[model samples]
Target: MTHVAIIGGGPGGYEAALVAAQLGAQVTLVDSDGIGGSAVLTDCVPSKTLIATAEVMADLEVADELGITVHDAEGDVAKRTTVDLGKVNRRVLSLARAQSHDIAERLDRDGIRRVAGRGRLDGTRSVVATLDDGSEERIEADTVLVATGAAPRTLPTAQPDGERILTWEQVYDLEERPEHLIVVGSGVTGAEFAGAYNALGLEVTLVSSRDRVLPGEDPDAAEVLEEVFKRRGMTVLGKSRMASVTRDGDRVTVALEDGREVVGSHCLLALGSVPNTADMGLEEAGVTLGKGGFIEVDRVSRTSVQGVYAAGDCTGVFMLASVAAMQGRIAMWHALGDAVSPLDLSIVSSNVFTAPEIATVGCSQKAVDEGEIEVEQVMLPLATNARAKMQGVQEGFVKMFCRPGTGIVVGGVVVAPRASELIHALSIAVAEKLTVDDLALTFTVYPSMSGSVAEAARRLHHVR
Candidate 1:
């Protein structure tokens, strides 16, 4: 039987082990962190759980319009809605731990050897695992997969003290709600946290170095979210670059490059991530490293070495959990000589979990603006949708792009409640290369947000 050595137990590593084992390979997974890695233990799962709690609070804000109201012991209407963050944090951590344990059980059932140690490539075909006791285990395999993942990026000037100043991963340890939160980034992570906390009844201030929040996302979507943030009483400081973060007692202060300062009860540094690839003997084994120490891999997840492959955040390809899993699966299929297709990032759908979420797949508005891809487009505001109005959702829209002549769907963007769920149909359209006519003819539940998706596609059909 072929032996597969996998490093790190994130989605990329564990998912690969399952596929390799099912394909009749002996798999030894060297995962120093618990099963599911940061995606489950701290980053994705935990943050999304917290965001779910925030969504509930946001819904209550529109309760009056929905003919709903909360009552106190005396049967009087309650004016303020508050969240028990202590309870919410506990629940978030519990769910994360449960998911990690579930992944562990699955891997055990597959008969994959799990090691609790740090692993690094010793050469082209060997992995060296350093256990907690300082002992080492050398794993020899026909193929090796590097999926060590990444850590929250921090700087010397804006270090997280894990208390008043914290990284996104450290926020779960908090037992109480903060008086004010200063999120020092306006990207996905920063915007999510700011929106979540603001919805949860905390004063929030989002600091952005750029002209607007979510500079990486669609401009119209970003504009809607920023407007919602301001309407919800959250302070958004755009064009303000962060210089440093310092905590003085219970209060934290954020210093901007312009010498201005903002004080808050706590600070969150969403400065992005750095791939965990150093000291891993990757280069020593002839594997190439890209900018920021990320592993350099091809479409099939192959490293420079013949038998070595890499995936996940370590590769810095999209930095998304779903993409990581796809990369790992592709790696195993290719390594095992099975029928394999290269990773197609264009068809992959991604979402920002902020209230009034932003989801996108395939082509981007930037590509069209820069004349990278030519297409006909249609955008329909959710406010005009019957379901959106019924649900008191006034923000967000559905936009679709298609070939001018063939009318084939190339991309789409949905910015609305549960946009993540709504983007899947469009993802299929893009993947299958379905034309606007195909989507327009499809049935979408009437008086639903999905109707707007189909309606937009219908409008695009007229381009031909």
Candidate 2:
């Protein structure tokens, strides 16, 4: 049987281990964090759990409009609810730990050896793990999969103190809710946290270097989210680049590049990520690294060195957990002599976890605008949908893009509550190369957010 050594233990690493084990390969997974890595132990699972709590708080804000009244012990109407940060954080951590344990159990059942250590490439086909007990173990493998993932990018002028100033991962340790939260960077991570805190009834200031939040997402979706944020009393500082962050006693002040300063009780830096590829002996093993120390891997997740594969954030792919897992699986399948398809990034679905979440698949408006791909498009407002109206959702829309003549659905975007769920249909359409007419003809439940997806496709079909 082939022997496979996987490093990192994130979605990419663990998923590959599972696949390799199932394919009759002896798999060894080396991890510094828990089996689930940062995605479960620190980042994705924790943040999404926090957002779920924030969603509840946001939903309560419109309870009265839905004819639901909440009252206190004295039978008096309660104007607002309070957020218990301590409880919320405990729950988040508990959920994260539970998920990590679950992943560990799964790995155990699959007979994949799990090592708690930091792994580095000893050579092209060897992994040296430095265990917590100060012992080192060397393992020989036919294939090595590196999925070390990424860390929060920090600036020299703005270092995270982990108290007054924080990274996305450190936010779960906050025992008290910040009175005024200042989030630097308008990327997906920053926007999600800013919106979550605002929904939880905190004064939030989002510092954006770009003209709007989510500069990388759909323009219309970003615009709608910005509007919703502003409407919910979030202070958005556009075109304001943060130069430095300094803490004074209990307050933290963010200095902008343009000579402006904003002070808050707490600050969060979400300025993207840096791959965790350094000191891993990758270059020594003949692995190629690109700018920002990201491992250079092809669609099949193969590194420059033969039998060396890299996946996840370390590879500088889409940075989504799903993409990372898919890459890892592809690597194992290809290395194990199984038929596999190279990754096609265009069909991948991604979502930003904010109020009125933004989800997208396949071609984007930016591509169309850049003349990268010509396509017919149609955007349908969710407000016109019967279910959206019933749910009192006034913001968001579904947009679809298809080839001009063939009408094949190329891309789509959904900005609505649970947009993540609604994007799956469009993702399938894009992945299968289903035409707009095909999507339009598909049955959809009435009075549903998914109906807007079909409606947009139906409209695109007619526009052709």
**Residues 273-298 of candidate 2: C-alpha lDDT, one tens digit per residue:** 99999999999999999999999999
Residue-level lDDT of model 1, residues 1-464, one tens digit each, is: 99999999999999999999999999999999899999999899999999999998887767778888664656433244567899999999999999999999999999999999999988789999999999999999999999999999999999888989999999999999899999999999999999999988889999999999999999989999999999988999999999999888998999999999999999999999999999999999999999999999999999999999998999999899999999999999999989999999999899999999999999999999999999999889998999999999979999899988899899999999999999999999999999989999999898899999889988877543
Report the Cα RMSD per candidate: 1.9, 2.0
TM-score of model 1 (CA atoms): 0.97
lDDT of each: 0.93, 0.93
Deviation of model 1 at 296, angstroms: 0.4
